[model samples]
Target: MTATPHLNTEHPKHNLTGFIIFLCSESVIFLAFFSGFALLKTAALNWLPPGVEGLEWRTPLLNTVVLISSSGTIWLAERCMSKGNLMGFRAFWLLTMALGAYFLYGQAVEWSGLQFGFTSGVFGGTFYLLTGFHGLHVATGVFLMGLMLVKSFIPQNYAGGEQGVQATSLFWHFVDVIWIILFVLLYVWQRS
Candidate 1:
């Protein structure tokens, strides 16, 4: 008689739960910033303040488009992964990463040309606080996606374990949704 070893296949619910809790906490921080901005804007004589009139909507609009499109790519990647189409998954994931990088680059360019600092005034302070934090989240999402991409290349790493990809897709979509709200608040609402 031979003794056989058994594989442990316990499914832990901690990963998804932990991620949801993290998102909830992050949303609280963002809500605080939003409330502060609303209060400050309501009290200010002018929204953008002096020397900041050159803030054009075109660049931010373009970045928004890029970011939104990345959300779609991520969806496709997740679909491919679910279907076990590794090639399609990798291609869409890479495209998603490139779009995220492009969006971040556009943000850097726009920030460089701005005449305001984080402490410039209420307008600048709130603007930088919100957008900077959001940019950091986007960078984090991109970094996580890159890690997943690399893991996918290894046969033993991501084999039959695509939960990371789904988690990453959720995070990317969250970042995109946040940016859309911020864009409307910072650009469109500010103009009205």
Candidate 2:
């Protein structure tokens, strides 16, 4: 007779702790980017990105609101999931997805206003490098959230959707926080 291996069926297979820790490491990466952004901005020579002209205020302000609101909606989604409220989770995730789309759309509008494209100069280089990286983060957040939204509709006995929900929330919130730091450093501080 051959010996058989046993499965640990007593616990959930999803690893929330590991996912949260991964998010924390990503937070540190954004922190370093913020520090570099602060230094480069303050040390600028003759002109800023648009040549002595600085970044716009109104658009970024609107984008900030969009991203922050999405974070809030995602938080609400997580709460709903914890309570086993599938309807609430689906509604919240849908709203969050819409807001995420809006934020990216807002960024595209702002990019259109940028006088210099990627080839402009130092300002173009640094501005695009940092903000573009952040935009990628936002895109990932949307994709992950969308995945969770789809998972919500599946039959019972699903185990990992909650983990995805929390991870996406952490990532979306991180994106919002990073933009706050970037906007302050790149636009506001450069002027005054």
Candidate 3:
């Protein structure tokens, strides 16, 4: 006789669906800003504007490396969780958080060195608005990861599937992808 395994308590599948809906809504918000920025850039006499000749691109590029690397670290962390290696999971996850913090710090340092104000012109305004919103998202992602990190230490909290880690990973990857687009538009294309 073949033995059939009994089902455990049903883990909610709706969490993934809810997160997808949230992502779609957030996509609309980003799309609006992107479209507006494109329109404004085309209409303006000068996209760079006065007092903002060139952004110090090197620092942001390095920060981009750090931020993008966090995505990889988080992926490894998830892998660790799947393998039931809590120590490996925590180490990689904490490394991801630290990289995120470094990226934010680099952004602050770059902004401090810049000569333009928010009111400088359209370029300055859009620059800050777009990047600022993205930064806010990164911050939120980091905070969420921090909470997950704390919960992970609890034996019960991590016994189930890594739903929280998965969600945070998706969000963090999205944030990093957005930054790549912004970096190209704001730094690379603008330079040319």
List, residue by residue over 45-124, the lDDT tens digit for candidate 3: 77776655777789999999999999999999999989989999999999999999898899889888889878788888
Residues 1-192, candidate 1, lDDT per residue (tens digit)?
354444354464467767777887888888888888888888778777676674679999999999999999999998898888889999999999999999999999999988889988788888889999999999999999999999998886656556677788988999999999899889888652
For residue 26, model 1's alpha carbon misses the true position, in angstroms, by 1.4
How do the predictions measure up, each by TM-score?
0.89, 0.85, 0.91
lDDT of 2 at 74: 86
lDDT of 1 at 18: 72
- lDDT scores of the candidates, listed in order: 0.87, 0.78, 0.87
Arrange candidates by TM-score, descending: 3, 1, 2
Give the distance in Å from residue 90's predicted Cα in candidate 1 to where it truly belongs: 0.7
Worst 10 residues of 1 by lDDT: 1-10
Residue pairs in collision within model 3: none
Query: Which candidate tops TM-score?
Result: 3
Q: What is the C-alpha lDDT profile of model 2 across 21-80, one tens digit per residue?
A: 787888887778777766665676744544546778898888888888888898898888
